[model samples]
Target: MIDPIVMIVTMLIVGQIAVSVPILFAKANKSALNLPLAIFLVAIGALALNPIIASMAPNWYALYTALAFPALFMLCPSLWFYVEGLTADTKWQLQKKQAWHFILVAPALIISVMILMLPKETHTAIFIDDTEVSGWFVSLILVSMLIMMLLWLSQCVYTLIKIVRRLSHYRKRLKDLFSNNENKELKWINWLLFIAVCTWIISLITVFSSSLLDQFLFNGTTEALFSLILIWSLIHFGMQQQPALVTDEISPKVKNELIETLDNNKNEQSKASKTALPTKKYQRSALSKEQSKRIADKINTVMQSEHLYLDASLSLHKLAQHLDISPNYISQTLNQTLTTNFFDFVNQWRIEAAKPKILANEATILDIALDVGFNARSSFYKAFKQVTGQTPSDFRKAHQT
Candidate 1:
């Protein structure tokens, strides 16, 4: 019979499996679903690979280990694909063949891991190894898994950093800045995807560090960590509120051409939308475009006098007051013409101005970041990433020599 601690651990493993398995099948390619699925697979696999759990429930353990390995490799690619779909403002879809790619590797990797158990495959047995394995075979498994994990991890990390860089400027409308919500609320789901990816990373760390888990168990820290991780996983798994679904055969070619002409084009070559003014100088019933431009020009003059952008904390209200225009007018002017909010408009200017100074090397990242109106390092990193599509370090390096 399994000891009490072993039984408790086994139940914990089962609970993780129970929560994650269904999510794995349900949330495929969806950012909200993708990371949760990865988390679930890692949690289940980590438990199965845990020495104590393996000793207590060998069959279940082996089955889970086999399943989780390739999933580990697949998670990052799937995440990148999901981000691509998000970038495109569409629901991700994988054809049948693409869905089964992980399964192709499953049988072989699993079979190899369980090669010694061929004779005892049918027997319900548990084996515990107290001594740490330092042999060639164990090392091979560890090294291979590490390499795969690192590769997958790197791909996701790079993509997320890129995503963060691309989305850092907008403070008020961060959701829409990083994602599109024209068809469905994909933006909201992308936030949950970030959480799920972090949870998946936690699960991976827990699973691959059996000795550390044993140490924690000995020091009575396992329960606390497990509880936190379990709760985190549960929260991440719950991210599948509703998928951005569309059933119609959307006109791909026409939409693609339009997107290429408008969305991707640096040049403004498409007709303005029905609601948008054909010319920037359209007459308004209450305040004409000429009047608005006068107001904007006066505000620009005041901004130059006060150097408001240097404040970094300057807001719509303050700018509007100084310009003798309502905040609504300022917001509308920036949004309609610049295709961005007032906050983003100002921040973009600051970040752009800072880039040259960053290249000049008169100040460090922190000083330049703060000088550009960003209060914190994180905000600085995010703002720079958004404006430049690269980190400050990257941007600096590119222009330094």
Candidate 2:
């Protein structure tokens, strides 16, 4: 009989997939991540189904063993694909070249089939009763399975590490591109990948040790439980995540400016190093005092005339796009010349804009707050107090005739 705990966990896995798959498809956004997620669910579900398969048809255990390896092989590939989709600037689609990623799955399937296609006694001995076969064929099969498992484990680890590195790079990229990236940071995925690594490690331990396998089916049960959590967390959190692609977020003219900035960055890439320089104070190396003053003046002019601060979503990168300036240069100009950061600089304008609204007393405080590009009432109050030395109500009452 299949272990009840394993059975329960497997059922939970099935239930999670049943609910999540439909929701994922129904959602209009982040559909790029759906295919990889679907593939991952299918792979996990197939593995979880093994206990049921073993119970119902003991005689057909050979066939289950044959297919399970290939299913297992799909897990890492699916994960890598999901990360690729999640991090892409535009909607991700499978290209003809990416077909090679699944090349191992076919071979794994064929090997399983070939083993099952062996003589009846050989197949039975290999799949059902290993003690009955002490031949070279059985030894060869054992070695091959061991080798395959090791390779699969290696690939899973490699892909997971790549995901970590990619996520790190993405975080740095976001920092460079946006003044406020609280919403765009993908830290949840890091936790997900960590859990996956733990799951994979537990699976490997359970597979190699016969004593552990005999005591309790923790391997399958743990995997099923973790898979359930992973899927649920993904569905709940993943749906809320918005893409942070520069091309999608900015206009065509802004995109052209960004492209030029990128081209200039490429030119500077060779001379730059990742090493951190000693932190003292802002220094103007290539940017002269006159150039810095010009940039700072231009920034004030643009912010006042164009009312760029009215965009609640504006960032250093977005502002750079507007002025056809590189974000690095913009940051330098703001710090060295203007002696202000992006947050204070933008909020200063927002505070100035709020003054007229407060004086007029035409709209409610909340409405005025939102209209002046403050997303939250609390944020507006905080910035207003910081800038004006008085609350909105106090400021309005004091100015009233």
Best by TM-score: 2
User: Model 1 RMSD to the real structure?
Assistant: 13.4
Per-model C-alpha RMSD? 13.4, 7.4
- Backbone clash tally (model 1): 2
Off by over 4 Å in 1: 1-52, 59-64, 81-87, 95-143, 149-156, 159-262, 265-401
Supply candidate 1's per-residue lDDT for 116.
41
lDDT of 1 at 3: 53
Q: Give the TM-score of candidate 2.
A: 0.69
Expressed as tens digits, the lDDT of each residue in 88-193 for candidate 2 is 6556776779887777787687678778767777776666555557777667777878788778878877888888877776664554344345557777887787
Per residue, candidate 1 scores C-alpha lDDT tens digits across 288-356 of 567666766766666567667787546554565566555445544454444565556677767877888
Off by over 4 Å in 2: 22-31, 119-125, 128-132, 208-220, 259-293, 300-312, 316-401
Residue 332 C-alpha lDDT in model 2: 58
